[model samples]
Target: MTGVRWILMPLLTSAACVAQAGWIDEAELELRFDDNLPRGQLKRDIKSDMAVAIAAEGGRGYQLTENGRLTLTMTLSATGYRQYSGLDHVDAGVGLAYRHKFGLGPLAPEARASVSATRLEYRDDGRDGWLYSAQLGIGKRITERLGLTATYEFERRKSDDVADRLLPTVAADVYDLTSRNFTLGGDYTLSSDYVLSAAYTLRDGDIVSTTLRNLPIFLASSAIAEDRVFGRNRYAYKMKATTRGASLGVSRVINDHSSLTLGYEYIDSRAEGGIDYQANIVRAIYLHQF
Candidate 1:
């Protein structure tokens, strides 16, 4: 929080310099239930947890030209889990974005690009590092109450420990991976105060899975057990995987400054040389605009 505040102070101090400005300053509270919190593919020993998160962000946008604008934002968030202590984490990030509107057809088309950097701190005192992401998106407003968007994103995540390798096994690096995501989404206004949104995300990347040493693994000669597993570390092997996901959400506008949202998400992961699993999640969020 201190690091994020230092970055935010400069932006807040300079906010008065911009003219004809539009700004966003909001706080978000979310409650989520995860049937499978660990992203584990195996059916056995699956853990469930409840999580609560609080986040705040403030940003300002300045019109650069008739159709172009630049925006900058800083955000801080922390999440705590009821059962999974290892999943607790805090996040602080800054984002810079640019958008341009094209007045071509009846519906204006918009193009967007953004870059962000976030610091992640874990409660377990391991697997902590920064994540960097870049996104490019195109969107069109089809009607007064409907919009569609397609986006592509690239992200890189690093862990504090070394990555696991096949030979001369080192088990420290299970949290490190790079991912590319393609997403298509749409939002529609159902009424004066209600909205519906849905999206499908396809992610291809390297994933990690940790499981116990079993009989099938001994026959295949493919398993590598970590030294710390038998003693302290509960998870042993790190297996790579791919994931696909989808989400649906409905939001109710309580007022211009506040809203409530309910959402559902599904994820299917296929692990290489490991187990495969599916996950379902339900979440509720409240947003307050300042």
Candidate 2:
């Protein structure tokens, strides 16, 4: 969160400040079960786990134009894992977003651009990092009941330098990562209080796979490190991979300020040397807006 926070103030000061004088707050609690938590390339190393996360955010909005507004938000979250305490962590972040619409009706096309930076502290020190990301999105209403959106994002993770390298040829910073992603999604209102949504995402990036020493994977990996979290004799390998994922969800509005969601997601990732893995996840979430 080094530079993004400062940029938000300058944008707000240039705006007309027509928005009302109250902070917007949002809270969420989520429980998730993942069939492949470690992203292991081998069946023997695959691990499953359950996790819970809670998050809260607050922000203020400023009107920049007749059809555009900017929001500055601060967020905090904590997550715990049932099977792997090494993945438990806390994070805090700041974000800024600007949104604009083409016209004044429900069917008007809308666009949003946002940037954020977060500091994530993990139980495993090697996994700690500063995550920075930027995203641009556009949305249009296909009908009164259906809407579609597309988004593109780029992100980077910067972490501590590793002192102990498992292999002389392997890179030292195993946790440093970068990725680009594109997503397409659609949502349909089933009723006044219920909605269904589905999305597909394609990502190209660096992935860390934890498993036993596999010679073929070594040829495809860029980094290597000892991963003691899952147990002894396991290692972490960093490799370039392409991932595709799909998710489906349904949301139910509880009242004016609260809602609940149930979701399922599946992901498949393939590395350069034909090393691959798959994951399935299910989630339930409760959210409130204030």
Candidate 2 backbone collisions, by pair: none
Off by over 4 Å in 2: 1-24
Q: Whose lDDT is greatest here?
A: 2
lDDT of 2 at 90: 77
Off by over 4 Å in 1: 1-24, 104-106, 163-167, 214-233, 236-239
Measured with C-alpha atoms, the lDDT of residue 162 in candidate 1 is 53
Model 1, residue 89: distance off in Å is: 1.1
Candidate 2 lDDT tens digits, 1-290: 22222322333332213223334387677889999888986789899988877776778899999999999998877777876877877788999999999999999999999999999888788898899999999999989999999999999999865748766767867788999999999999999999999999999998888888888888888988888888899888889999999999999999999999999999999998789999999999999887
Q: How many residue pairs clash in all the candidates, one count each?
A: 0, 0
The model with the greatest TM-score is 2
* lDDT scores in order: 0.73, 0.85
| TM-score, per-candidate, Cα-based | 0.82, 0.91
Q: By TM-score, how accurate is candidate 2?
A: 0.91
Query: Candidate 1 — which pairs collide?
Result: none
